[model samples]
Target: VVYQRIGNIPGVRSASIVSGRNFFSGSGSSYGLGFVLLDSFEERDADSLSSEAITQKMFMRTAGIADAKIIFFTPPSVPGFGASDGFEVRLLDRTARDIRDLDQVATEFSGVLSQRPEISYANNSFSTTFPQLMMEVNIPKAKEAGVPVSDILSAMQGYIGGFYAADFSRFGKQFRVFVQSKPEDREEADDLNSIFVRNTQGEMAPISEFVSLERTYGPQTIGRFNLFNNVTLNGGAAPGYSSGDAIRAIQEEAEKLPADYDIAFSGITREEIASAGQAGIIFALSILFVYFFLAAQYESYVLPLAVLLSLPIGVAGAYASISLMGLENNIYFQIALIMLLGLLAKNAILIVEFARQRRQHGLSITEAAVEGARVRLRPILMTSFAFILGLLPLALANGVGAVGNRSIGTGAVGGLLVGTVIGVFVIPVLFIVFQYLQEKVSSKPAVIHSNETKPNV
Candidate 1:
């Protein structure tokens, strides 16, 4: 019905809605709905609303739903980890209370979950209204009728749940027979009473005569997480919110949760928390290797220091750019920083290497520095400008994981701009300083031809 209404909206070529179970067939995905667009969202005029505004408006316009929230499932994972895409909180079932009380607690926590302005689509994994018929077998009555409890259960299964009868082959293929009652006969809750079992006297006896029946509605499915009954609450960060912010919101809610209730994150959020510093570790290791290689190449510690020290300029740029752009210091930005470590280091190395060569050729320290800076300025500008321009598209991209992409691109640009332009000025000065120290230590006051010495040796 909602889809039908949405389809009527102008510029909406088609609207599709898919539930998690319908799509995943109970595989790995959770319970939710996926709304898709068949045509690009079009704004009819300047006053026309944005897609998000229109979606929220239409959702509110559709009258009937008691509670409605517009939530965008976090965009699909690149590697396709097969599960519903949403922020999830696996609230492991509480042993401290029964399912009913546990449900009440979950409801309260759900309210807490939705309270965060940064969160949306807070919902539970459990679906109800599964009408269940509970039967209490009268053992004595069944025995007096010569029907065993097992026989009674089998009879009920055959009628209500379908039982395997036998297999028959036709056209060279065998098919299993499923025995069930006529549709009309078992159409209602009272129909189960009419089911019959064979007694010792070989007479058909209605199951109702020896069974007590109770009717109730319950969950359609029971889920266990890590060997404990659990209900997962699914949600995601609001637009323009990062997962880090979402995690904080989740943590705040968790901290206030009852001691008996435990919460664990799964999917993307789990990976984020678990691999928190792994990216930094990778970045640090990259720099370590870079330094090791540079040291081997220079065969002098002081020259390598000059090159590595110049990286601070680029690092400063990355930090400043992301902060100014309101981007997170996330994995993408960190990865870009590692790349910058190499990039800026190379810029520094170029100047340092040239200046050292000049010094080796007997040029004065300041002269060597000024000459190297003069020579490398043009090449530095060309390559860094090219790299910065190349990143423009990435920094401006908008869509799934666009946040990370923009962070990476923006950080790279900022770092490159600083490292190349300013580095042309700074690296040579660093080389001159470190090189002067090197020459001072190396040129050691001529062992005065040992004129005053070594006669004792």
Candidate 2:
């Protein structure tokens, strides 16, 4: 039914459903429909995209479904990794000892996510509910009848495997067992019930008469993370929505959760959170490294300060470009920013280092600063444009990792061009200001050379 309904949708080239029997093979406990989208499918205003959107919107309309999910898949399966392009919401039950209450809470949370328009296919991990027949040992009754509970269990194991009776010596090995039952006769549950067990009276009694089987629905598998039972709510972002926006929506819905329920994200969403935390550390480390390196190269702390001043403009330009391109401030974007930090520092270094050399050569402060900026302009532009052009292919390329490629390429282009253009004017002023400070703090006079006529910068 699921496959047929999804197959009916316009963009779906084909839809195949895997049953719980096949899907929940002990290690995993989830079943879903895999969709193959048409080649012509496009996310914006296309027939395939429209069809997929409508299908997900109306998914809950199906009868007898607790939760449903739809996501894109392209394979080269990675071990110990989830196979989802969409976000996965894990509901952790702290107080619940078993899956009973945990599953109920999971279902309720799934319902909340399903109601949100920004997310699609909000499904609980406990999707397959199968009837399990539990067997209880009637210990008191067995004692009264003079039949031990072990005897009853032994009888059951015998049906599956002949009960061990005694050891017989043969070929230097001892083995002994006797069992009576045809394979065909014990093929079904009814056949097992028909088998007899010996009571204290030494009389055969029907197995069904001693054991009671009650049918109840239970999850086929239990998933645990950090020793707490977990149920995942899986889904993809809606059209025109970023994964971050979808996650924020999920966080909003999490407010209504019961006290025992804790939330955790998985897959790319979890990686994103981890990356964001590390980004701050990476940024700090990059700045410290650049500042100290410049300090060492110039052999003075004050001149390095001037080099650092040019960094903000380049970083700002990078961010502005990303915003204009509608790219999220994801890990890829942050990584690009870190890389551009170096490039921006390089541009400032060229100007500041050149001007400091001119100052040492007995030029006036203005002449040195002007000469520094004017001379290095071509080299800075040349190198920056060369790099920008090199990244152009990455920005324009399509397919896997294209988003990340473009994010880095476009950011580099913006940061290099905008920062260099602005830094040319700004660095000279910063150089003069910082140089005056250097002159004031040190005992050296500003005029380092003899009475030579000043040449035009």
Q: Residues 1-457, candidate 1, lDDT per residue (tens digit)?
A: 6676667665456666665453222532233455645334333332234444455556555646544333434344544542455566778766746776666777788778778887754765454444676779999988887999999888878887788889999999999999998989987767866877888888988888888878886665666777777777777665556667877898888888877888888767788788886876886787788778877887766668888888889889888888888787777888899888888877777787787666666677899898888887778777789889999998876644566798999999988887786788888888878877876776621222324446655
Global Cα lDDT for candidate 1: 0.72
lDDT of each residue in 1-457, candidate 2, tens digit only: 6655556554556655554433212333344444445434233345335444555534643544545443443331233345556676688888766677787777878787877888865766574365566777777877787777888888887775576677789899877767757789866668766778898889877776667767777877777877777886667767556778889999998888887788998766787666656777888888888889988987777878898888999989988997887666666777788888888888888998899888987787899999999999999999988999998987665545666888888788888888988999999999999888988888544444655768769
Clash totals, every prediction: 0, 0
TM-score of candidate 1 on Cα atoms, chains taken together? 0.79
For candidate 2, the 10 contiguous residues with the lowest summed lDDT are 20-29
Let me know the TM-score candidate 2 reaches against the reference structure. Answer: 0.74
Alpha carbon lDDT of each predicted model: 0.72, 0.73
Give the CA lDDT, 0 to 100, for residue 353 in model 2: 88
CA lDDT, candidate 1, residue 325: 85
